[model samples]
Structures are given as structure tokens and as C-alpha cells.
Target: MARLVRLVRRYFILGSGLHLVACGGGDSTEPPPPVTVTITPASATVNAGETQSFTATVTHATNPAVTWSATGGTITGAGATITFAAPLEGGPYQVTARSVADPARSATATVTVRAIAVTVSPAAVTIGAGGTQEFTATVSNSTSASVTWSATGGTIAGTGTTITYTAPATGGSYTVRAASTVDPSKSGSASATVTPVAVVVAPASRAAFRGEPVSVSATVTGAAVTGVNWTASCGTIAGAGTTVTWTAPQSPGNCTVTARSVLDPAVASVSMMTVRPAFLVTSLGDANDGVCSWTHCSLREALTAANADPGTDTISLVVPAPVGAAVANTIVLTTSLPAITTPVHIVGPGADVLAIDADATAGSPRRIFEFDGAFAGSLAGLTLTGG
Candidate 1:
């Protein structure tokens, strides 16, 4: 009985074969027909820990017995059905089926076992800004034992398990990957990154009166760790800090301020500012109820504008006495005033008429006039007393 279950259903495959059978029985004894065995699927590739079914067809012989064997790996089957199990590693192999009746006749198919996985070593890496590192890939279950390499944001060299990498000059993230040479689809990957080391300065622009102090700041990042070296093109830097003081030149002009990393001279930042002659007070605003440029006639506003100006600005007091109410001559300050940083004269109507009363509620009066070391200004005709 010829038991044919089904055609090949993906177990693995074998090459096709051609055979002719001639059976003639007229004399009393009859000879057996020639037996041809063929395994479907001439060639195939499969991953490890996987299975593919191979079907065999018996030609010429009725109730034929066929045996399946492999050059590598394992197979399981009965009758004309055989399952070829791929090895854990990747390699080229062969599968064959032979007719038991005609031991000399056989059919063979090619098999290539594929790697289950390929893992790139050093799963994660970090590199300094403009640095370099090496990478490697390890392939699992591959008899071929070979891999191709690649990467992002940098140059990679060499092949197989080991390779060289040159990091990007700037700070950022990057990765490396390895693919199995035998099985292109089977691959693994790794990662690397570049970090930045430098410093930055701020207050991109500013203005100060000649002989006045200019305020600026600096920030350090990445590698420039120790501190900053400050420099001024047209003035003298008085001190060192994230925020620093710079005295302007006696002649009105422009200046460039810079902060360089103590660690790396190549990394630095700069700011620009101008110096002017003098700034005269514009509005003798009594708007001291709140803080603003307009509406609130607070001296805070007057002085803030004066300090913010780039020149030697003056703050002259001239009160517009409200018609109905007594002229509010006393400028009572509840909070401490901002430090004066420019060269400007502070003049008033009279020492008695225009008084800067530092405290009305506090037991002790606060200082009313705070000066920057570089401020060159005159105070007259104004009575000022503060704690």
C-alpha cells in the first residue's frame, strides 16, 4: 500500500529527481519496478530552535520504504514524512532520502542553518565630546562565525567581531550595530555617545556710563569645570564670579567683555557694550506707589532708568505739587533702593523741601544711596538719611 499523506509543508526541502519504472509480468515471475525517492524543496534556510516539515514522494514502487538522513542536525519522521530540525548554529548542510528497496538510489537537498541571534557587545557607551571608542559583535548559534558592522554619527572600520570607531567632534548620542554574515536578517546592536565640555557667557549686550561699572555673568558646562578667566577689551575687570564687575574706560566708547574656560582656552564666550557721556534725568516722576516705567511716579523707576542707561545719567528732582493736597515733598521708601551703578548727579529742589525719608514704619532707616565702586556722581540739595 502506498501511503501518501500530503505534499511538502515547510519542514525543509530537497532537490527533485527523475526516474522511470518498467514492470512487465508475462512469464511466471515478475521483477519489482524501479523505485525513485524525491524530497520536496531543493534548498532551504531556517533559524535555530525552529522546525520545518519535508515531504517525500515514492515513485515507481508501491508500498516503498524510504529512509531520511542528514549530514548535520537531526530529523524525525515515519514513512514518506520527515521533519528536519536545524542546528543551533548557522552553516551549510545537506539532507538526503534513499529507497530501502534500491539501496543505491537516493535524493539529496541543501540546508543552511541560520543563527538565532547576534549581540553587539558593550551594550551602552559614553564618550567625551570629540572622542573615540571601539566596538564588537558576538553572533550566537552561527557555525559561520562572521558578522558585518555599522554605526551612527561616527566612522566605523574593520569587519567581523571587532571594529574601530571615531566619535563625532560635537556632543550627542550614537549607536553601533552588527549583523550576521550568514543570516542577514539576524543581527544585534550597541550604543555610544559624545558629551560636550565648554563654557558660556551671558548678558549678550549692555551699556554703561564712562567711569561706571558694567555687570555681566558666565556659565560653565561639560568639560570647562574649574572656573572662568575674565577679560575686557576696553576696561578693567574688578572681580571674579559668575556675575562680575567691569569698570568702563574714561572715554566714552564701546567694549567687548569675554569669559574663557580655565580648563580649555579654546572654549569661551563674549558680550558687547557701549559707554556714553552723561544721561540727565528726564521725568521727575513722583510715581513711587509701585514699580514700573510709567504711571507709578516712584523714584525707583527714575533711578532704575538712570542705572540702566549706558551714560552718566542725572536724577534731578522737581515735584509737581498736587493742587488740592499739600505738596508731598517727602519720598518715603519702604524697601531698599537699587544700587546706583552709573556716573550721575542726584539734585533736588531743596534739602528741606525734597527729603528722601528712608523709613516711616521701621524703627531704623535703611541706607538710601548705595554706590558701585566705579560710580562717579555728586549729591547735593537733597536730604537723605537711611538705616
Candidate 2:
């Protein structure tokens, strides 16, 4: 038992010496792994005031978010997806996305900024003279909404984004333009085609005596106007064009001349005319035949004779009868006479004894006294039947 206790004391002393050697060096924790960053869509091209997306990927990263920045643009929203907006002035720029976990670890991408493009609405249009058209300018990748407007023809109204284009009074093709205020160098243009307009005419007033010659004149405006059509309400317009010779109707009163535009059929003008009166006839004949006399004759013969005379005359009437006898002075006829075209006044013997009986020509319905539409005259002291 004494030998076993000596051996146990020697083993305990050896274990203490080995433990002191192992505890002399070496740390319990190791340093973190090095991080590296990478970017997606390594390079891109975009217009001024345009937005583009960028992504950042980090290996061995400790933080979940990435800090976004640009050397010449605006940046928004960080992390893997970053939004970068190009500057208003176009140029090359560098966009960087850095790892939030390690400031030293970051990635960059190249961005090319291009000029903005402008477009115009209603690129082309057609209108008649004195018409108007409206145009608009739309700018892509622009920072402002306003635009300046101008035109090569007619008038213009308004200044910003929208503008009105008024066509010239004369017809032709015209040009209109809109310039972008955001980018002065960029502009949009449009074309306007104007068509012909309608025309109008005017005529003058006139007055003349019967059988006298008269004329009318008129002028026209608007579309290309040549000659005009001529017409008369109570006379004859004899000429072919704008100026016409007017012959007063034998039987006349008030009249008018209408001038119509030849180039534009819808346009017309009118002038007033007046004709004076002449001649008065008192007929013994009941017939419309131009016969005139002082004694017992049919009313038709009196008119025929009066119309043949040079100057206006009145027919004094006396019914033919047996001398010194109370025989009836009734006159009858059997044939139709020409119309009473001239003015006249028929005076009979008396209303009681001067009955121009239609008994001789009453075999059928007939006109005892008929006046032409132009005749303005009177019939006194006569009883006419079957007229």
C-alpha cells in the first residue's frame, strides 16, 4: 500500500505542467469575413429628367440595406433596388450603391443622359379661310409642362402648352410650331392647309321712264369672282355679265335687278328700279281690240284706235241710236278683242241707258272687258255683263 500512494503523487504533478503550456497563446474569437459589392445593369442610357432602376448585391454582408447615391443625378429608395433620376442637363454620370454594413464595400454603374424629345398633336390639319385650329406640345422626359407657340400665317392666341391657329382670310398652306420650354433646342411643328371661301355681291339703285334704257352695276368680294347673273322683276335685263342693260317694260311700275355671283353660285345682290306711267284711253269699243272713236262704235274698236295713236288719249263714249227716236242704245259684240295693255278711262252715256249688253256674244261664257295685268286704268258709267 505504501508503493501505490507514491505513484499517484507523481501523476498529479505531470498534469499541472501540461495545462500551463497550452494556456500561454491563441484568441477565442476570429475576425469577420471581408465583404464585396456588385451592381446589376452595369451601365445604362436615359434621357434628361428620366428615371432608371439599379440593383446592388453584397457578398458576406452583415446589413440588409444599401446606401444609394449619384455623382450627377438624384437617387431615392436604398437597398437592392435603387431609383436614380437623370439630371436636367444631359451628360455622363456615375451612380453608386454602397453596402451599409461596410462603408468601404460599394459598387458603381455608368449612366448616359440624352436630350428630351418633343411631339406635337394634330401634326397636320385642313381648314377654310377664316377658320381656326388648336395645337398642343407634349414633351418626353421633361421637367416643365409649358411650351411657346408661333405660326407662319394668320393670327395666334394663348402662349403655354396649348395655342390656337387662325387661318388667313386668303387661302393657302401654312405652318405652326410649338417650342418646349423645358428644352429650348427641342421643338415640334405642324401644317395647316386653308381652302377657298365663299363670295358676296352688291348692286346699286336705279330709276327711269318707260321706253328709256337703264343699266345696273355690282361688285363682288371673297373667292375668285368672275361675272354675275342678271334678272329683272318688271323689266328685261339684256346684258350677259355683272353690268346689264335694262329695257323698261312697255307697261311698268316698280322693278328689281338681281345679280348673282358666277364663281360662287350662292352669292347674290339686288338693286331697286322704278318705271313712270304714260297714256290714258277712254274707249267707245267694249272689245279689247285697239279701236277708238267719238261716236257709235263697239268698245273694242275704240281701244284699237287709241292704241294706234301717238299720244295718250281718252275715249269719249256715245251709243249709236235712231235719230229723234227713243230707241235702245245697247251695243253688243260677237268677237274677242286684244287685252287692254295701255292705261284707259271708258266714259259711257249714262249708267241707266248705257248697258253694253252681252246678249250677242252670250252664247258662251265670255269676257266683255278684260284688262292686261300691266294696265292701270278706270271704267266709269258703264254696266258690263259676261265680263
Candidate 3:
């Protein structure tokens, strides 16, 4: 029994020695110390004065406090967590985290913040006076940047990517620019233009007649026209938007009219018209009366005698206006044996009676006779009125 007790005591001592050796108290093999720490995102990038955040870890560490710092910036952290602030000037920066127990074991992380670029579409737009224009802006290299767009020399409205601006009453060039809300230095710019609206005298001509209704057509260029007002000496017309119909003055003269755009009263044009009578004829010839006679030995003979002596008449020869025989005033009646001075006259509708005044002298007997015969009728219509 005593032998058994000694053996048990020896066994107990041996077991204690083995435990100490396994624990490296008296063994050649030894355990290693805590491993170095590694941090993800080895580097960090941020806008000037901005902050970045990260977590730090290490091997063989339990709730171990850590120290944090920035190589080229400012850092703030209590233990396994850290926040690194970017420098005033933008550039690459490193953040480090070390275990308080093993200062040699440290970790690093990197963060990147991009720069911003902005551009405007339709670099320049021209709008007529009193017009409006819309603008669109494109942003690049920035995700959370807000922009403030402005037109220094014009009227501006709206916000963000799409904006609108109105032209002034006058016309000129306008400069516009934009800046990022986060970084004003990273900005872009563009320009716009406003031009004067030109007025045109449509139809070009104004010739018209007085008191007549004239139609005038007008077109306003360089801008859109909504309505037109027309004025003339003849007075105003109704519904004269771009076309005017007015009556000219009643008097014979010239009239002028002006057409003005309703949207822009300053733009206008003019036209003119004129008005004037016409001349007409009604009579042109005369009639005279005298006498000729036909009488002789026969109505036929007397008629022949009177025609043969067309230059001699009894009334002309006997008149005192010539007094005496006055150069004979005679013409040969026929080539008979003795020429006779006979004044012949015929009267009656049917077979006419022929009268003859034969020889006549103050001292000689005058012979007056009539030839009444049916043959005289043949010369009845011989109406010799005067010579």
C-alpha cells in the first residue's frame, strides 16, 4: 500500500511538469506576439477641407485602443475608428491607425473626392427684344454638387440644370456664368445675345385713288407680331391686324396711312394713295336761199335760156344799185338769129304755165307772155331757186 501511494505522488508531479512545459514555462517552442493591423482603402481623397471616415483592425487584439493620425492632413479618432480631414490644397493624403499595445503595428486607408466641371449648352443664343430663352447646363466629375447660374447683364430665372432668361427692352449681348455650390472654383460659363426687331413697310408702294377703298399688307420682321393698328387721313379701319382696308378722302388729293405692330409699338410702316375728272362735244354747217327762173318761147325753151345765161338776172340788171344798163350784165341765151333777154318763170303743179319777160325798154313796148302747154309740164320740177 505504501508503494502505491509513492507512485501516485510521482505521477502527480510529472503531470504538473508537463503542463508547465506545454505552457512554455520550461519548453523550447514559444508562442508568437500579436500580428500587425491592416486597414482597407489604403488611401483617401476628399475636397479641400472635407472629411473622410474609416475603421482600423488588428490580429490578437481584444477591445484594444488605437491611435489615429494623417500624414498630410488633419485626423480625428478615438480607437478603431478614424476621420481624416483634407488639406486646404487638394492632393493625395494617408490616414494611419496603430494599436496602443503594439505601436509598431499600424494600418492605412485612402479616400478620393473628384473635382467638378460644368458646361452650358448652346454656348450662345440670340433672342429678339422682349423675348425669352431657356438654357441647360451639364455637370461632370461631381455627384453632389449644386450650381448657381446667373446672367450678369440680363434678366435671369429658374434654377439647377434648366434655366430661363428674358431679354431686356433694349438689345445687346449678355454674359452668363455658373459656379458649383460646393466648389466655386470649379465652374464654366457661356453667353447669349439680344437683337433689335426690325420694322418693314410691307407692300412697299402706296399709290391709290382718292375715295377708293385700299388694302394694305404689312409684315413685321425679326420678331413675331400679334396685331397691327392702322391710321390714315381717311380714318381707322376695323380688324386691321396685318391687313388694313380703308376708304380714301373724297377730295382729289393724296392720303397716307401708317401700320404699327401691337406687340411692339415702336415698329411701324407707311403707304399713300391719290385721286382726280374727265372732258366731252355736240354741232358743225349753214343754208342760204335765192332764186333762178325758167321761161321762154316754150317752158322748155325758157328753161334752156335761163340756164344758158346763168350770170344774168332781171332783178340784178334793173336794180338802181347798179343804175343804167351797167356793162350790159347780159349773157347769150341761144345762137338764134336774134338773141333775146328773157326772164323765165314757171308756175303750176301739172303741165306748168311758163312766163317770159321779153324785150324791155323805157321807150319801147315790153312784151310779157306765158307758154301754157303740156310740154311745159316736163320742165315743171326744174326748181332753180337762186344762183
Best by TM-score: 3
Query: After best superposition, candidate 1 residue 55: deviation in angstroms?
Result: 20
TM-score of each: 0.37, 0.38, 0.46
Across 212-307, the per-residue lDDT of candidate 1 in tens digits comes to 666788887664244789998988898887779887775557899999876556778898878654332324433444333222335676677677
Ranking by TM-score: 3, 2, 1
TM-score of predicted structure 3: 0.46
Cα RMSD (Å) per model? 20.0, 15.3, 27.6
Q: Which ranges in model 1 have alpha carbons more than 4 Å from their true place?
A: 1-94, 97-112, 126-128, 143-148, 157-160, 170-172, 180-186, 193-198, 202-220, 223-250, 258-387
Predicted candidate 3 versus true structure: per-residue lDDT over 164-233, tens digit per residue: 8776645578877777765677677777777766555555555443234567777765553346677876
Model 2, span 1-387: residue lDDT tens: 998998888887888777765675454457878888888899999888878998888889767577888899898885699789898777889998887888888889999998676778899988766667788888776767677887888788887778888787666788888777767777888898877554333335655545456766766544333567777787777767656687776554788878776644555677777664432223333554332222234566666654554345455465554344343455565665556767666666666646665553335666666776776767777666544
Output the TM-score of candidate 2: 0.38
Global CA lDDT of candidate 3, please? 0.55
lDDT sort, best first: 1, 2, 3
- lDDT of all the models against the reference? 0.70, 0.69, 0.55
